[model samples]
Target: MIFRPIVPQELNAVLAQVRPDPSTAVSADTVRARLADGEYRHRWIWVAEPCPGRAPLAVAIWWGSPADAHPSNLDALFARSDPMWAFADLRRRTSSAPRPTTDPRSAVAAALLVAAHRVFAVDGLVPAPDYHLLLPSGWRDRPETAASVAWRRRAAEGAGLRLTAEQLRFERAADRPVPSLSNRLSFTPEPDDEIFVDLFRRCLSKSLDTTSTRKALRIGAEEHARDEIAFYRHGTRGRRSWWRIARTTAGQVVGFAIPSHNSVVPVVGYLGVLPEFRGRGFAAEILAEATRVLAAETRGGVIRAETNLSNHPVVAALELVGYRDRTRRLVFSAT
Candidate 1:
C-alpha cells in the first residue's frame, strides 16, 4: 500500500472518494479558503492507497499546528479498505450498518491512523496520543450516525488511544445580572505576562488543564502554567485589551481576569484565583468582573468560556454567573 500527502491537483479526486453523509464533505471553495486563510496552520491532508495505482483507501485531516493539531469534525475522511481480520470492524458495524456486507471504513481508518502518527513524528510536531472526536448534542439518538462515530472511537482505541473528557463550552449574555460592586477588589488595566505567570502557577495546584497535561504528556504543572501564559496571550485573536489583575483593598492580590475580544465576539479569556484563596467564591467574582468588562463593551452580546468537565468548580462558577450550557466536546488522546 502507498501512503502519502495528497497533492493539490489530486485534492478534488481524493475528496470525491470520501463518501460522507450529505453536508459533511469539504467543498472546493472551502479548501481554497483554508489555503488562503493564514490564521491556522492547515497541515498536509494525507491519503492511503492499496497498491501501485489502486484508488485511495482513506484520508485524514487535522487542524492546528501539525504536531499539536486537533481533529475537525471530518477527521474520519477514511478511504474504504479491504476486509481485515480485526474485531474493530466487527464491533463497529453491529449497529451502524447491515452485518451481511463488508465495512471498508475501518480498514481504511486503521491504515490512516498508522500513517498519521508516522507523519506527526517525521514533521516534529508535539505528540498527542489521540485526536478529538466531536459527538454532536443528539448523537446517541441517531443510531446510524452514532454507530459510525462509535466505529471511529474503536479504531482510535485500537491505535492505543482512549476517551478522556468532555470539554464543555459555556456562554453568558451581556444581559446577565451583574452583581453590584463596592470595589472590594481593585481591577487594574494590564500587567506584564510574567506577573500573570506567577499567579497562574499558584493556581495550578488543582488545575484541570495541568492535571490533563500531566496525564497526556507527562509535563510538570509549572510547564503547563507557562504554556498557558503563552496560550492566553496568543489565543486572543481580536483587539488586545486590558488583562486585569484584581487586588484587595490593602493591595493584596485577589486574582486575575482576562477580558478580551476574539474577532468580534468578546471573551473571558482566563480567570483564576490563588490556590490558597479558594472556597471564598473568588472564581465567580473574577468571572463576573470579567463578564462585566466584556459585557459593557458588547451590548446584549455574549462572552464565551470553555471548561473541562473534570473542573466542577469552574463549571459551577460559570453557571452561577448565568452562563448557559452551549455545547459539549469529547477529548480523546492516544500515543
Candidate 2:
C-alpha cells in the first residue's frame, strides 16, 4: 500500500471517508470547518491507498494551532472495516505470504501513521503528535466505548504513541451558583507575563497534572511554564487580563487562576497553588475565582474544565465548585 498525504484535488474524496461517530468529536463537517480556519491542512491529512488515484483504505487527520508550524494532535483516524482482504489480494498478486491479523484495519492505521511521521519529522515536528480520545464517563464499563477505543488504542501504540494520561472532563452552567471564594485570599491581575510564568514554574514543581508533568520532564519546568503562557496568549481566545494571581490578605503568594476560553466557550482554563501553599484549601479558592470569571462572560452558558484523574485535590476542588463530570479524555503521545 502507498501512504501519503492527500492533495487539494482529493479533498472531497478524502472527506467522504471521515464518517460521523457518536464516540468521537470528529466529523466531516468539523473537518471542513477546521480546514477553513487553517487548524487542519491538506498536508497534515494522510491516507493509505492501493495505488495512485485509488480510494484510500485509511485516513489520519491532524490538528494544530492556526499560528503553529506543526500539528499538535491526531484528531481522527479512519480505516476500512476489512483491510486484510486488500492486503491478501496484493500478497497473492506478488506471490508472497499474507500477514496474519484479526484486526487488519488497525494495522493499516498504524502503517499510515508511521509513514506520515517520517515526513512530519523532517519538517521539525515531533515523532508523533498526541491523539485525544474523548469518551463518556465510566467508559471502561461501556461495551461500545471499549470496543471503539480498542483498535485505535492498538493503532496508536503500534505507531509509537503510548497512552500517557487520562483526565476527567467537566462542565458547569453559568447560571449555577458561583462558589464563594475565601476571604483570606485576594485575586489580582498582574500586567507582566513573567510573574505568571514564575508562578507556573513554582506550581509545576510538584504538580499532579499529567500533561504538565510530562512537559516539565521533556522540556524543563520553566520552559514548560513559559510554553503554557504562550499557548494562552496566542493559541486560545482568552484574554490575558482575565488571569488573576491569588495572594493572602498579608500579600503572600498562594496561587493563580486563569479563566479563559477556547475557540468555542469559556473554560476554567487553569489554576494552581504553589507547593508551599498546598493543603491550605487554596485550590478550591482559586478554582472558585476562575469559575466566577468565566461565568460572567458566558452569561448563562456553560463553562468547561478538566483535571487529571489522579489529581484528587483538583478533582475535589472541581466538585466543590459545582462542575459536574461530563466525560473523560484519554491522551496518547510518543513521549
Which candidate achieves the best TM-score against the true structure?
Answer: 2
Candidate 2: C-alpha lDDT: 0.85
Candidate 2 has a TM-score of: 0.94
Q: Write the per-residue lDDT of candidate 1 for residues 135-171, one digit (tens) a residue.
A: 5455568787677666566555544456456677787
Return the TM-score for candidate 1, rounded to 2 decimals: 0.77
Report the C-alpha lDDT of model 2 over 230-304, residue by residue, as the tens digit.
888888888888999998989999999878887678988888899999987899999998888877766638899
Off by over 4 Å in 2: 89-101
lDDT (0 to 1) per candidate: 0.62, 0.85
| Distance from true location, Cα of 255 in model 2, Å | 0.9
Q: Which 10-residue window of candidate 1 scores lowest in summed lDDT?
A: 93-102
Worst 10 residues of 2 by lDDT: 92-101
